[model samples]
Target: MWDLDVQPLISSSKWLQLHGLKRNKLSFSQILSQIGFQHREDFVSTLGKFVASRYADGLFPQYLRAQDGRVYNLTAKKELILHFVDCLTGAIELYKQRMEWVTSESRQLFGVIQESCITIVLDFGTVCRAEFDLCRDALSMVLSQQVAQLANDIIFSTAQDLVKWQQKAVPVSEDSVESAVKWLWKLEHMPAVSHTSSTEALLEAISDETIEAVYYFAVGDVPKDMKHLLLQKVSNSPYAIHTVSFNAREEETIIFLKELSQLTSGRYGEYYYCYYDLLISLILKAIQVGTRESLQRLLSHLAHNKKIKWLNGGRELTVK
Candidate 1:
């Protein structure tokens, strides 16, 4: 028999060891050897900060599984990691400025990191929770109310499946998915519907389902416990739930995201795009408006520094 089991070698620590580093114990020099590259750690380190500012988004590229647990790592990407670091550095500076301007008496901000919904950010201190909720509700109503028509047509293999499915589904309410829960959870088989259905109509349709399964959205960064819950929810789903990510500087966007999250595999979140908290703090602190224009300028600065590479978008233009 072989001396080693193929499993333990794939452990998170082992995974990091193969790459020659530990995540929290991160250092430039250690990372280089771990990933089997002989590049300068100092140079790579710079790029990580930049990525956080304008482009640090979504799942890390590297992944490891030891035992039954899983983790997505980013240290492997020499370029991407550095870019993110540079961006984070800039983000912190801006954050500092905002903190300085906002007196503790008038406003306070709270930040939390969740494990399961790794992408969702819940960023609001207790003082501003009410204001944050108001903006989020407004945003959700817009997405639900302002849906565009998506009259997609689908053809079945034959009359039997078509008639059988139609007969099964037509009686369901066409309002929100919430209404269709009974049908979804109890029914033995179901056909997936298109996302174009109006929110009101969709819920109505949901009511007709005898066995409707309610899918939960991860509202904040997922914790390990939460991750298991989500996995259980989507175990039978055909589609993947890539995180629905966006930046919400104001109430409108926040609300839109909340409503949209319900339709997706689940809205797993990282940072709270609160109206009164993150936005107001940043504004007061002098974090430049995160408009398309300002973002471009930040991107340009990273590109010029070579901390970030501009592979797409305009190449000729330069930012000062």
Candidate 2:
């Protein structure tokens, strides 16, 4: 304590200070030396002109977020950015083509059916006797439309029981469709005596591993409790359960059936005789283009090198 080695303490403190300075200098050099890394700034500077005005502010940022989980400060190759733009262009073209087909050639039922072998589950008990004739006619129309296109089975379900026209899916033909129509008319005379839940009927339809999908043609309001039960039961099925809402009145029924289809990775259809406003809006969006002035700006941007030139004078020059 009396001779506390003062010189040694001072020497150790100076060594630590010098070492920290060297480390800080090395870090700064490393940061400055970094090169050839791609960044969002570079992307915006190089390709920002190609984006349309309406989308310029948000589209590239959103695209970057989806592609690399970054809206800015991104480290992505220029080639990767160009590839992403190409994919977006291709997808827009494909959507246009599909919408064209949907508007021109597709009916709700046939359009939603993506599988060759399917079961059509018609909930008959939900409709009253007065509306039974309408039900029969609609089913007849479906059979006629789907003739020779689908191999299908029809399961007719009432409040208490279910009936099947064929034990398994039969290949569609003129005779088969005619037989189905006849069987549907004959059902008006039969009473539902067997005890089976709607969920059980759906299970029976899905039990056939060969069946590719199930189409639930819902015509009226399903009980709220049963709706929950159906969703829970079908949510885990390996095959999809596409739902068709035919002349349904309750909004709740449409929403529940749509959710059921979404949960099972299936399609939903609204079957009506008239066109939907939604379809019209989609068609307009597919065919719409920018104004004449904006189109000219886009053309000039694309032909910048061919249309624009530099002059030897310091003043700016313009060419058309």
TM-scores of the candidates in the order shown: 0.22, 0.50
In order, the Cα lDDT scores of the candidates are 0.31, 0.57
**For residues 1-320, what per-residue lDDT tens digits would candidate 2 score against the true structure?**
21122111112245335433233333322322231222233335566553323434532323233555433333346786575556556545544544443443234444534456778777654454434565677677667655445644444333335677887677767787788788888885333333246688887878878777787777656777788889777788788888887656567988998998898888788754321332234345445754665455444433432333334346545444
Our tally of clashes for model 2 stands at: 0
Candidate with best lDDT: 2
Give residue 217's lDDT in candidate 2 (0 to 100). Answer: 71
Worst 10 residues of 2 by lDDT: 1-10
Model 2 scores what on Cα lDDT?
A: 0.57
